[model samples]
Target: MAVNQESLLKKYISKDQEKQTGQAPRRGPGGGPGGRNRGMNATGKPKAAKASVKRLFSYIGNDKYKLIIVLICLLASTVSSLGGSYLLRPIVNNLVAPDTSVQEKISGLLSGILLMVAIYVVGVLASYGQSRFMLKISQNALQRIREDLFNKLQRLPVSYFDTNSHGELMSRFTNDVDVIGEMMNTTIVQVFSGVISLIGTLALMLYTNVILALVVIISVPLFAKAGGAIANRSRKLYKSQQAALGGVNGYIEETVTGQKVVKVFNHEDISIEEFQVLSDHLQKSQMNAQFFGGIMGPVMGNMSQISYAVTAMIGGILCVLGKFDIGGLTIFTNYSRQFSRPINEISMQMNVIFSALAGAERVFDVMDQEPEAADGENAVKDGVMDGQVTLSDVTFSYVPGKVILNHISCYAKPGQKIAFVGSTGAGKTTITNLINRFYDIDSGQILIGGRDIRDYSRSFLRQNVAMVLQDTHLFTGTVMENIRYGRMDATDEEVKEAAKLASAHTFIKRLKYGYDTMLEGAGANLSQGQRQLINIARAAVSKAPILILDEATSSVDTRTERHIERGMDRLMKERTTFVIAHRLSTVRNANCIMVLEHGEIIERGTHEELLAMKGRYYNLYTGKAELD
Candidate 1:
């Protein structure tokens, strides 16, 4: 069942619909800075940023069980941590207090210890359970994200890949995902811990002595001010670090993958020197961020320590003047010291948030990019595409304004064979791409089955068109699965039949595991001829009416090419075929040889007729033939 063109357009956002560069969408800043504002700051209030924190949860998507359970665990963990704080009060008031009966004191002390132990035990268990649960959720989310990203990569125009680095894209999956995972696991927990500790400690401090608590409360603004300022400074540094890391990774991937080329061209020294600049930048960015942001924890701790010392001294003088008890003074000082823990925790965790935020920004950038070839609404509906294809005044470009195919037009009947031959980059592949709407035509109209191709659903157009490209990619799977990829629903017997038609079944049967032999990733274990044979088998299984073979045998040996040529001849008979090749010998028998040069059809005729004219085809054949 083919999806209609209208539906594809409706589902896909066009390349033209992309968001402008620079300004990014706002997600939540949660866990710190806005703990109370766990959800969005939806109201038109002064703290609108706080509202976005709530939106973060919403952005992750709502579910019945997954999120609700996580929320429940967060609440349970916070409660347990807060409950532990109350035990501290009992420990201070009973065991350390004078004028307490032995029996009363022992009971108080034991109860406090038991409460602390209980909360600690439960909290530990809760943390472990929550960690495991969050991992499952993160993994599920990561898996969904990775799948979507890869699918997007597949659908994107080849031009996009040409412009982007494989390493940079791979980082989105590896580094960006790891960043999200670390934040979800560690940063979120620290935020929870800091918040619970802060609120519980503040409440205990006020209860113990309001006057001293006011002093600590005044210090809260100091910590926040410092953290906010440092966060602003560190964000740029952290972002630079990530950017530098990406560059280095990109450089390494390119260098290693093209190492053979580098050695042949004697480019090692220059490449290494270029890589050092990025590596050095990465080191400096990290050092700057950590040195600047890393100083904050101790600075805030010193402020707390100073406040603690001052309070204890003031309390000591007051106690001597009969104003407060020594036990009360101790608790006051202890609470002041305790106050620093959460504040310092917040200050230090800002680095993690910055790093995670940077990664999220990168990940989001990719997620927000526009699809290359989205169809229009109310476009063509899906069918077998049983009509002839007619191109009229069509022009196109992989890059705008530099037309690869200029004012080109052709028409082929349902059963006619169309062979394309020309110099490389003469727009042969680009022309084929237009047939499937891989890149929409810059100008002119293409009719499929008497209807405009744009009107036909993109999937329907693709479903009927099967291409056996020169470079065939095989997924990591068994020999059977590789062939079955042509049509997933194909049975073993059907797959074997296709292999036989492609002349690939003979070698496949001789393999150690036959059809079931598992292949290395990318089918690296197979020989070039074997891989091409398997691809041919795949194309045969598709049984598409409109077959496209783009130099299918150009990469194989002469013997292998002959074998494929025979198989292809058998396969293409009576089917509408488009054969693109640099080898003039293969297409000598084509129904029509459409010669292209600089994107325009220079000549079109049968091989004998073209040879009679002694045109480009004639000279190319005579020029490049074995000449033996």
Candidate 2:
């Protein structure tokens, strides 16, 4: 009876659900930086096998010249091996015949032995050539794949990263890509060799004796069935293994980055317990995957032996009846062994092929995601921005049907400082986000210099808008290099100037290596205040027309904040600036202060004007109601 693939898949899913219930969910192994987990769910959707395979071959076709050479070498190597086997028949039937003279027999046998060695040598050389050539081709293809993946990441919107974890994405570069590399190095070449060898052996066997050849052909289906069953089981197991490994990796990344929090909260023991559960899942899944894959070799080997035994029996009966010669029977048996060897080898590789295809499917799925919205044909090409920002009836929600900002209208004239004071989640930072187009508003007209922000190219728009966020991140580099990241073409003198303007030069000069000091893991060696200072210095170097400080000074002390405020006052002198802060003191010098409630602006004016109003702003300023 034919199997119902859909029903089989549903049954597998049900069993997997039961297994998950009996055990904890998987967490990936290892630790590194802070990042979210972006791995697929353990029972995530399976990819279509045929489509994935076809897509995988498209990558292989990238280096067609090398692939063609590899094929030629592989064919040459296979043909030499098969031809050497056929040469055995002539050597046994003629050179060592009973009627031959001793002297002549020795001469013929010596020449034939030399010819076989020559053929074997050629086969060895061709195999080596193909191996080396394939490596180059495979590595080049992998490089393109990695490049495409990373470039795709750059083009992807921030919203994509918001939903995915850093660890999960990292796995695609490591585990999945590694598996594909291994398949290309070993399994793929073996598959080519096995196929060519099987075909040649079949033709030679039939030329020797049709009856015995038919017997070997009969066992092909049995071998295929057995191999197919193991491959199916192994494919499912490997998928779970990959997912479990991703889970373990994600947990490690999160725990390592948050170790300080874990220790402060006295949760080390609980963390270890959780890690153990994830590690256990990975172990079990890997063991099961390997077990199913490992059985294919032995099962195929036994089937080959069975085919060989049946062929030998029929050959012996024919020889006894004087219908076949001893030399021909010997050649026929060898051909029977050669024919099944390829079948067995092909079956053994089915598991690896399936696993690699599954990994490719995962990678392609990420690459296939929709990229960020592109610029319109008429998008601003001149890169001129006046820094006069206006939002008219802007409305947006991170999620649909749940509005965060409703019909919000605001404006920041050129060369003026605008301050936003609101409780948490009151849309202060969201306004700044809209100005840069990190995300587009659902329904709104956000204009910079009277032109809609969407009319400007995203890169050009962002280049003109510099933001200093509450959470500062620094890469592994010298202090000078980190500052230069704001403007790659900035001069050394300019970097020093920006640092001075941010009040960071004093602290940087006190460091052992000064500006040359190398930072690691987002500058873990530096204090939070120091990191924020560097972040501000970076934005200062950009000299963008519009500046946004979203709680930029939140990490500094009152004394430090006072010192930085003086530097910030000078920095904001001629730039259009937007400030978001809970500390009312930070916004006291603003040209205008807007007090927001929920998603609407309830009060708008200078500090004294709001104080005189005796409304929501007055209450917040006086501490009657805290800034939530």
Task: Please tell me which predicted candidate would have the highest TM-score against the true structure.
Answer: 2
For candidate 2, what is the TM-score?
0.91
Writing each residue's lDDT as its tens digit, candidate 2 over 476-506 gives 9999999999999999999999998888999
Clashes of 2: 10
Give the total clashing residue pairs for model 1: 8
- How well does candidate 2 score on lDDT at residue 339? 84
lDDT at residue 438 of model 1 (Cα atoms): 65
Kindly report which residue stretches of model 1 are placed more than 4 angstroms away from their true locations once superposed.
1-56, 59-144, 151-157, 266-274, 372-382, 509-512, 557-563, 624-628
TM-score of each: 0.82, 0.91
Prediction-by-prediction clash tally: 8, 10
Candidate 1's TM-score reads 0.82
